[model samples]
Target: MTTTLAAGPAPVVARPGPDIASRRRRARTRERTAQWLFLVPAIAYVLVFFGYPIVKNFVMGSQDYTVRTFVSGEAPWVGLDNYVEVVTSSIFRTSVVNTALFTVGSIVGQFVIGLLFALFFKRRFPLGNVLRSLLLLPWLLPMIAGTAVWKWILDQDGGVLNEALRAVGLVDAPVHWLTSPDVALVAVVIVNVWVGIPFNMTLLYSGLQNIPEELYEAGALDGATGVKAFWHITWPNLRPVVSVVLVLGVIYTLKVLDIILGLTGGGPAGATETLATDSYRRSFQEFSFGTGAAVSNILIVVSLLFAVVYLRANRRAVDE
Candidate 1:
């Protein structure tokens, strides 16, 4: 009849074997793999440069590693003897105390001064960018060079700092900034603080810039301005960055060697001898590699403990 009796079931149309989602999934996987391939070189470089030394240090800490081990490659296992000796040594307590003081002092000075500088830079002014760039010179200079310059500035008799103090009538006699045990650590801390300030200021300023002007404007409408606005808006917004800066500063300051070594050489009756310098003395100077590794391992643990505390505090802050 008219329709050829039901048209024998409409002709079947061919459909794609895979769903759109499936095709997209395959494409995303390929893209991710390609992106990861680009990162392989960087990952490998880090493993070779950082990972190997960490592992080697751990192994050495557990063995009777020495200068001879480097030549003969025969390091006998000594278990925790190295650690025991390091912990019991007379210098251990002093080094620990010095390490704590150095890290705390440097971090406090750096963060406080850096925050002030960052706030100063936030204000609009002529040549502001140029001034900020110039501030980075101290940070850009090599650590040894900065330390050498600082040594001259803090020298006992002929240093500029002493001369300035003498001119200003701050003291009766030239101060022994590096030689006197009482003030050597202070001098080292001052130099470290100077070198670290630019880094902190740059990071903090970046954080401040990331904040939207709209937030400040809105807060201003709600009777929030100046110090009040900073407490309510700026501080809250800057907390995460501040946390990172503090934690990184602690880690870096804990391992500071160049400035201390160049300035005081951990001398004047070991006034400036922190764990880092002590570790260096043991390994390179005294050729007690195992003891040096042990001290370094302790430092690593301290750094890790601090990082853990910071993470917990950050989590609590986020939750609240």
Candidate 2:
């Protein structure tokens, strides 16, 4: 005879009480609100600092905002007159050209010298770390102090450089570095390059360190050594880092004011007067805040264009 099978008890289904359901919903809402509260300070900071300044600058560019306007609290709308005056001014062309030269010269000199230093330091040597650390001194010094020292070194008469040259019989007369229009731009570029080299070197050295040694070993096995190996391996690997460095260099160079102001004060026929200095001159020196704002807005546009270029470059780099 077959044994009868016993039926098992049904599984119990527990439903939540309305009170429990509401409590869970309330808990989730509270958690989300807490999270948002954590982010509020940062969001508010950006809105207040960056957003407000940029919008105010744009608005100021369109109005005749002078020193008098600050006292009177009346900035009359002038449309594009500020922009028109900025672009049409006699020194506008000179400032534009000088800005281009300064940016290019500073970036090129800094990157090249920095790359060489980075490569040199890649090899293990005595006091290598110490030397690299010391290189940052120029970068760490106050801009005002650095420029002041450079000013003395580059003085038209009684400067160390001219004296050294005379001692070595290199030149018969003192070279007016900051005084002559032809030499002032070069002097400013030199100072800027010196200040920027350490930054480039630090970044490039870090990038070089990130590259795998095994790749270099493998490359060497295929007769890719020294320059060949670097061209095929190091450069390709470093392209992304190089792009970042170059783009940042361009952006920083574009807005350089303190160094130029301290070194030359955009003097000697406005030879070294960049967009930054020109904007300052218009606003503070000439008391034409509208024109200053207009110049600054134009500078921002130029910076944004470069930013677009950086985006494109970064995307291409990622694709590759």
For each candidate, what TM-score against the reference?
A: 0.91, 0.90
Q: Name the weakest run of 10 consecutive residues (lDDT summed) in model 1.
A: 1-10
Task: Estimate, for each residue in 159-265, the C-alpha lDDT of model 2 and write its tens digit.
Answer: 89889999999999999999899899999999999999999999999999999999999999999999998899999888878988998899899999999899778
TM-score of 1: 0.91
Candidate models: Cα lDDT each: 0.94, 0.94
RMSD each, Å: 3.8, 3.0
Write candidate 1's Cα lDDT for 255-292 as tens digits: 99999999999988989999999999999999999999
Total clashing residue pairs per candidate? 0, 0
RMSD of 1: 3.8
lDDT of 1 at 59: 89
> Which numbered prediction scores highest in TM-score against the true structure?
1
Error of 2 at 135 (Å): 0.7
Q: Work out how many backbone clashes candidate 1 has.
A: 0
Model 2 accuracy (lDDT, Cα): 0.94
